[model samples]
Target: MNSKKSKYHLLVLMDLSKASEAALKNAVHLAKEINGKVEVFHVKSPADVAKYENQFSAMRAIQEDTSNVQSKLMKLIREIEKEEKVVITLQISYGNAKQAIKDKIDSVKPDLVILGKRKNNLMNFLEPDITKFVLKECNANILISGEDNKFHSFDDISLGVYGETIHKEGLEIISDLKTNEEDPIRFFRIRNPNNSDKSVTTEQNKKWAVSYTFSEGENALDGLASYITGTNTQLFCIPRKQNENASWFGLSRINDLIYKLNIPVLILR
Candidate 1:
């Protein structure tokens, strides 16, 4: 287990929309609690402004609106800072939303990214789905905030392990969390007929309380959620797996769980 103290850093995607406030507030609180820094990103597309110039006025006007939104976001960050110690930075960029976010992630390298789940409607076209893109592309952990404003702790976490590919990364995450006093790590293996050998390998690790369950279907997220619901599990941890073809299965499943579950998720790459 790594003995290093955990330092938290977060990047939050902001658009000045109503759905973002809850996520921003939650991110601020988390930053305060974990003694971390928060970076807020607002992406602006110049092409969009030019394309809709007849509909909407100058690019300067759009820039001014973005600046105003950043100001309001900074004010909220200040409020959180006044009460606790946290470093806040804001960036307004002109480009594609996903590309801008990916660039920022490369430069800033925050531990996690917080995003708001917008309603599924026509407005989704205007409000780009950055979360989905980040999940697929970025190596950083992500937190998708729902309408509920509740904060969850990562203590007493669960790791839903599958194939042998994820074993090393999963153990590393659990070890780090356990070293930080986030104990009682529970491991759940999806039942498989062909993978009886893999199940035997997983059962060898008795350091933490482990449990085995049969998942009738291929959806590991549903099976894990069903097995652990009603328990005091706050966070679900998973590893990022990139295949030889460079496809990521762990991230896809993690994204599914993030939007479907109420609890926060932690993913390690």
Candidate 2:
């Protein structure tokens, strides 16, 4: 998918939280940059509607709640359309938040799906992690907006390669974004201590100057986390698909980095 030549259709899951707001802003920024379209989506669960059903007289509480949310979302969409000069769409779904979002993704066929992380997540067993669930199930590319970090551009893009094959599709993703030619990109290739190689490479492409940094560490996720700690990366592009086994670091380790890194992660398929 040539993101630059293609008209991007971005779908953002707006929960009205600060993190979701950031995701919406980022999506709008990207859409304005590439002359794309934005779809702001929200989901309501039946249980939530039932809680407020009695408050309303006759109508299905869910319907009333949906109408109210639709109005607020429309207001937001209009503001964004006027400010960004981009076509914006509003969508609302009812039922389980996860299933509703998955269905929307299938129906919309958006180029990118934007999600936000919860702040101070308490890890309640009852509250399903929508972001993780969607990432695992959805087939489209995803942009997870970290609650602890906010970014407006992908000027400093970082790629973490942990003994895994680098795919051309990943590079295509960068090309599609149409990032600036002067933007700096760092590729960290992590290896174990015994296999460490201090050699570095610099390659100049049509749009970016890619620099390679070799680091030694036993745990791939930990090494990436350490590199992130000492760098000011606006985005992290990782080449891992959904439901596949976490090759280098365990699945739990990947989750740890996603939660702790506190930066936007672009999962490349």
Candidate 3:
């Protein structure tokens, strides 16, 4: 299934961070490319009632908190929609952050989910392992942006091939967002001590996109990261390793790159 369709529905998670705002802008730019609609989702963590002096104070604070968060979100949505000339909607949720995000994903069933990744801390700029959970479990593909405020232009994409072969399904999904036919996706594989086969891929690979390889005696993930940085890739795409190939590169390695790489990362699921 090439899934070479016309439009898409993109859901962007917004937490009022600089990175998240960037994600929303990038998502808007992407929606323009894919002819997609955008949904800006925000999760307001419940105020700490325990910290309040009494129940009355807690109740008052909670009410104020909701109003502030909602007002800010609405303002943002309106500005982006008006400035970009794109129809966008906003969804706000309460309670647990991770659970709220998961619920939204299930309800929206979007074609793609855009979220932000800040390099300021390691625990989680969003929540505990929320990014990891979504990348591992979500059915739709995820586009993660760093603090870079510049609108992401998916002009030059770098796809990392795990083995001699690449994930065709993932490629098809990414191809749907290729608005510019002038620039083709560049797919590459790193040959090292563990996995090294100089054999060429089939003609089918050529039909999909251009292929490249890098010989690195060092770590494979590091090599892949270097290639993306050197090429000035706007977006980096990697396959979502199913259970069968989970051990190939492990998800933790991807998480470690949160603060390291500033470009948008596409975990093609």
The best candidate by lDDT is 3
Question: Using Cα atoms with residue i matched to residue i, what is each candidate's TM-score against the true structure?
Answer: 0.73, 0.77, 0.81
lDDT of 3 by residue, 38-103 (tens): 888877665532258788887787788778877987888788888887777887776787778788
Score each candidate by Cα lDDT: 0.58, 0.63, 0.67
What's model 2's lDDT at 127?
Answer: 38
Pairs that clash in candidate 3: none
Q: Candidate 1 residues 37-60, lDDT tens each?
A: 677887877675555545456666
Which runs of model 1 end up more than 4 angstroms from their true locations?
Answer: 1-6, 32-34, 47-57, 118-128, 154-183, 197-205, 216-221, 242-252
Give per-residue CA lDDT, model 2, range 47-164, as digits (tens).
7667653656424777777888888777777876787666677877777787788888998888788876666451221235776676678887787776653547643344433223
How many residue pairs clash in all the candidates, one count each?
Answer: 0, 0, 0
TM-score (C-alpha, index-matched) for candidate 3: 0.81
Q: 1 or 3: which has the higher lDDT? A: 3
lDDT of 3: 0.67
TM-score for candidate 1: 0.73
lDDT of candidate model 2 versus the reference: 0.63
Candidate 2: misplaced stretches above 4 Å? Answer: 1-6, 51-59, 120-127, 148-151, 155-166, 181-184, 192-223, 241-246
Q: List the residue pairs that clash in candidate 2.
A: none
